[model samples]
Target: MRLRNCLYHFAPYGFHATWHHLATTHHIPGRIESNPSSLVRALDELETARALMLPRAVAFAAQRRLQKREGRRVPAALHPWDSWGCHDIAYCPDPQKHPAEPLPVVVDRVLGACAAGTDRAGRCLVCGREDWDLWRVCQNCGVASGGRGAHH
Candidate 1:
């Protein structure tokens, strides 16, 4: 009932998926009481949400899959939660003020290089093919090599 009550407030797919997960995993008994109409409504809501972001979502999904194939970390997708409470501050790096180089920052830089396929001498991010002669379309999405979230 709580879920049904909440479902009325939003599109239905999010509600249904959320409800199904809650019911099956958390064993919420009220989900069983929820009717098929509610499930259909939830899916309709999902379709609308999907429509709003179809182009961007498809690109992000493709890039992520391509990154996985090449054994690289997909650059993190910036969801709303990524910047919840952060103050926007300018970077002021003073070598004199902070003597100790942060190890994690250094490691992150190294990891970023690896993710971009730069360390191994121009390795393609999508497919593992080396030289241009072997090149067809980028193993990544058909979008330009760097276009990650253009639609968003």
Candidate 2:
């Protein structure tokens, strides 16, 4: 789960390690990694492994919790962070300074301060349109005759 979170949060950097760990630890029986279908099938069922395994972990923990409660302990209700420790995944980089990096659109807008004349038109890597006042269609597609897509 820590591996999955690392992969999910850090993306490209941690993916290799996460993949290696997953491939080694949770390898499916007689499956080939080269097969996209096999990979897809395994990826699709990752939650099933969690569904099966987590309950058992929780149950075992629950027993400890129960005993602890009886032993004058407060029952830990399994806070979401309990599984992964104190690692709260947060967007570390300031998007305003490094807007080139791909980001979650919602948070990206906030971090990039989208309203401070950070026009999507100018930031369009495909098109180069600085003056948002004059152009409705992007420069890449219109004036520049470039074929970059809408979001590219």
Over 22-49, each residue of candidate 2 has an lDDT whose tens digit, in order, gives 3543453344644445444435444333
List model 1 lDDT by residue over 1-152, tens digit each: 44456434431112333344334433444545655455545444434433443344456567768899999976764332112111100011221221122222322332344346473455433333354211222333221122212223
After aligning candidate 1 to the native by TM-score, how far in Å is the CA of 110 from where it should be?
31
User: Which pairs, if any, clash in model 2?
Assistant: none
TM-score of 2: 0.26
- Root-mean-square deviation per candidate: 19.7, 17.1
Please state the error at residue 50 of candidate 1 in Å: 2.3
Question: Would you list the C-alpha lDDT of every candidate in the order shown?
Answer: 0.34, 0.33
Looking at candidate 2, the ten consecutive residues that score lowest on lDDT are 142-151
TM-score on alpha carbons, each prediction: 0.25, 0.26
> At residue 102, what lDDT does model 2 achieve?
22
The best candidate by TM-score is 2
